[model samples]
Target: MEVLVKDFPIDFVVTWVDGQDEAWLKKYNQYSQQDVLDVRNARFRDYGIFKYWFRAVEKYAPWVNHIYLVTDDQVPKWLNCNNPKITVIDHKQIVPHEYLPIFNSNAIELNIYKIDGLAEHFVYFNDDMFLNRKVKPIDFFSKRGLPRDTAGLNAIQPRYDFDYIHVNNMKIINTKFNKKDVMKKQFFKFLNIKNLELNIYTILLFFWPKFTRFFDLHYPYSIRKSTMKRVISENQNEYIQTMKDRFRSRHDITIWLVRYYALVTGNFSVRSPRVGKIYDLLTTFGEAKRDLTNGKHKMIVLNDDANISETEFDSIVKDLKNLFEKKLPIKTEFEKED
Candidate 1:
C-alpha cells in the first residue's frame, strides 16, 4: 500500500473568471454578440473562471504545495483561502488592462516560469476540469504503451480560418460536402488554402475539442524550471499583447498552447492508457475502451485516486500514506513533535 512521492516541487496554475456578479452579469447580458464578447473578455481580464475552481483548490490543498489562481482583475476580498500552501496572485500585478490580452499565456507561462526556476516540475490546468482519481506525481510521468489513433482527429474545417471566407463561396466551392462536414473540411482546406500552414495552430485551438481534452491529465512534465522561466521572462511583454489580439482570451490562449505542446513537443502520449480513450476525441471515460480492438495492454485508471474532491481529500491522503508504506518505507515509530 506504500504510495510514492518524488523529490520535486509540484504545483498548479488555474484560471477562475468570476461571472456571477449581478451588475457585471446584467451588463454582460445586455450586449450584442460582440459587446457580450467584450464583456466576457473583461470578465476573463478580471476573473478567469470561479466557483468550480474555488472548490478544486480548497479540496486539493494537501496534494498541492502551491496553487496559483490567476485572475482578470484584483483578487476579490471575499477570497481568503486559508491554506498556507495556496497563493492567489492577480494577473494585474504583472501588467495593466489593455495589455492583458497579449500576455494571457505569458500570465500562466510566467507563473510556471517563476516556480519552475525553483521546483523540478509543475502542472497547469483550467477551471472546469476535475481529476477523477487520487494520484501521485510519479503516476503522471510514468510511461505507457503506444497510444491509439482515433478517427476525426484531423477532421477540422478551414474556411473559418479568419473573419473572411464567405459562406456563399464555401457553398459554391465545396458542394460535395454536407452542411455539417463543411466546417471541418473547410477549416482543413483553409489552412492550406494559401499554402500557408501558419494559422493551423489557431484552427486547432477553436475547433478541436478532442485534441484539447484528449490527455486531460495535467500532471508532471519534467522540464527544468529555469528554462521555462527564461521562456517567460524573455517574451513576456511582446507575446502577451500579441496573444491578446490573436486569441479571444485565456481559454483561447490555453487551447493554442496545448496544441503547441502537442505538435511541438514529442513528450506527450496520444492515448491515456489508463482510460483507453484517445486523448483528444469525443468520448467519455466509460466509453473509452469500447472503440478499441481487443489488445494486450491494460489501462490502470486512477478514478478517485487520480484526483479527488475536498470532501474525500483526507481519506485519500491516508491512502497515500498506505501506498507510501509499500513503495517508500520510513520508520513508523518516529515520535510526533510536541
Candidate 2:
C-alpha cells in the first residue's frame, strides 16, 4: 500500500484574518458594498481564542512538517512569525496581482497550492477548526497516498448565501462524472462499512443519477497539492473569473469541488465522519464546549452565527478562551512570550 505521496512531507495550511486590524478593516471597508463594512459582522469578528488553535496543533499533531499561516499581510500581534515551523504567507505571494487585496477566503484558498515550499501532502484548516485529539500523519492520508475522507451524501438545501457555492461545485462535478459509473467502480470504497453512518445515505441517494451534493464537513480539508493544481487547471476560466470577487459570491466554486473530484475519481480513502464534528457557537454552545473539554473528537469547528448580538458573541468567546486555556495551557513556540 506504500506510495510516494504517503512518504512526502505533510504540511498544514490555515487561513486567518485579524478582523480588528485597522489596516485590514480599512481595505475591507474600501471594497465592501456598504460604503463601510459592518465591523460587527460575526464573520469578521475577532474571536479571542485563535491562539489555542496553534497550541492544539503543537500538542495534538506535532508531526506536521510546517504550518503555513495564510493571511492578507495581517499577522496576529501574538504570532511568532519567526518560528521555523510556521511560515507567514501573504496573499500576494500565491494569488496573481489582479486578485490582490482579495477578502474572499474561497479565492485565497484556491491558490494555496502555489505556496512556496509547500509539500505534496497538505491539509487546509479554518481558524475555527482545531486538532482536539492527538493524530498521526496517516490519519489524513492513507498508506497508498489518498486523502482520507468520508463520502456521505447530502442534498443541497441552501440555507445561506454560501450554500449556493456547493451547488456550483456539484454542477461542475456532475458534468464531469457519472453517478452510476462512479458508484459501480468504487462501490466498496464509497460504501465502506467502516463508515457505517454514511452507508444509509449512500443507499437512499442511489437512485439520484447525479451528485446532488456531498456531505461537506467543516473539518480540516485533507488535500493533495497536485490534485488542487489539477482541479484549478481543469476549470481555469471559471476559477479565474471567480477569483476576482472581493467578497463571497454565489458564482464562486468552493474547495469542496476538489474533494468531490477526488471522491468520484477514486483518489480518496474512506474514513468515518465522526472523527470531526461541527457545532454551532450560538445554538450549540454548551454542547460544543462540553465536547471540547471532553476531547470527544479529533477535530471540532465552533461554527459561529452572525445573527447573535456582539454582547452575546463576546461572552461566548470569553468562555471559550477559558476552556481552551484549560485544555492547552502551555504556550508553544508559535506565540510571542509575554
Candidate 3:
C-alpha cells in the first residue's frame, strides 16, 4: 500500500480588477497616461466570464484549501465573499500604505506573500486563467509539496511587443545562478521529457554559459510562499522602486521573477507547459470559444488583446459570455443566490 501525499493544503490566490467601477475608474483616469503599455483598457475591463471562474474551481479543483480573491476594495456584485472557502483581500492587506492606490499588477504581486494565512504551497492566478477539467492537487504540487512547473529556457526576444521585463528577470537570474551549475543540479527537471516538447529554444540555448529568459507560458503559477518571500527579501531595493509605479513600466519585474526563482533553486518539480495556454481574443476568439466549449485544455487564458478595437472586443466578450453560460450555467457557493 502506498501512502499518498494527498493532505498537503494549498491555497489559491487570484488577482483581479474591475475597470468599470466608478471610484477605481476615477483614480485610474487621474493617474494613468495613455502611453503606458499596461494602461490599456483591455487589461482592466471584465467580461461576464469571471463568475464562471469560480464555478469552474468549485466544480473541478474542489480540494483547494482556501481561495484568496485579491482585489482593490472591489467585489463582483454577484460574488458571495463571505463564503468560508473564499476571502476577498484588498491591496492594502499585502501592499504597504505608501504604495496605496497602486494600479500596477507587478507592484500588487510583489506583496502577495504578505497575505494573512497564505499556505506554504499556493497557486497564483491571473483573473483570466481558468480550469477546464477536473484536476487533482497532484497537478499543481508534487508529493513533497514542490510546485510542478515547466523549466524550459529561451533567449530574450528584443522584438517582443510588450516589455523588457523578462530581460530584467534574466539579468537577475544569470547573476544569481550559473547555467551550468543549476543545470547540473536540475538536469532532469530542465531536460524532462514532458518539459522538452515546447522547449526547442531551451535546448538551442541550453549551453549559453548563463541562464537565458525562460519560456513564459500564460497560465497559473504553482509557487511556494517561502520562495516568494525569500526572492522579494533578496531583491528588496529594486522591488521597492518597482512598487512606486502607479502603473506598469518596462523596467519593473513581473511575477515571472518568483517563478524563475523557484526554477533555479530547485523548489519546483517538472510539469509539462502544455497544461494550459493563452488565447488572445483578437486573433484566437474562434479557437478560444471552441476550446472552451469542448474543454480542450486543462486551463486556458482568454486574453483581452489591446490591439483590437473595443467594438470587436465587446462582440467577442458577448460570445464568450454566452458560451461560458452554456458551459457553466449553475451558480455555486461562491455566488449569491438569485
- At residue 312, what lDDT does model 1 achieve? 51
On the 0 to 100 scale, the lDDT of residue 229 in model 3 is 90
User: What's the residue-level lDDT of 92 in candidate 2?
Assistant: 97
lDDT digits (tens) for residues 1-338 of candidate 3: 32133566888999998898999888877777733757457778878678999999999888899999999999999999779999899998889999878888888998888999999888999999999888888888888888888888877767653548877778888888888999889877788789857567677878888876888888888888888898998888779877987777776887789999888888887888878878988898888888898888899998887787878878887898899889988889999987
Identify the superior model by lDDT, candidate 1 or candidate 3: 3
- Top-down lDDT ranking: 2, 3, 1
Return the lDDT, model 1, position 297: 21
Error of 2 at 129 (Å): 0.6
Top of the candidates by lDDT:
2
lDDT tens digits by residue: candidate 2, 1-338:
44333367889999988888888888887777832222337777778788999999999988789999998888888999889999999999999998778887778889999999999889999898988889887789988778999887778886877777888899898888889999898888778887777788888897797888887777999999999999999998779867967677877887888898998898999888888989988898999989989999999998878777878978997899889989999999999989
Q: What is the TM-score of each predicted model, taking all chains together?
A: 0.45, 0.95, 0.96
Question: What is the overall TM-score of model 1 with all chains considered together?
Answer: 0.45
lDDT of 1 by residue, 1-338 (tens): 32333444566665555555555355445533433113333223222223323443343334555666665453544455564555666555544455443323423444444432234445555543433234454433333211111111223243333212122222222342243343354344323333233344445644533332222223323343444544345444434543454223322222223222222223333333233222221223333223212322222222222233344545443543444234323321111222
Off by over 4 Å in 2: 1-6, 34-40
Per-residue lDDT, model 2, residue 143, is 84
lDDT of each: 0.37, 0.85, 0.84
* Model 2: per-residue Cα lDDT at residue 139: 82
Return the lDDT, model 1, position 204: 61
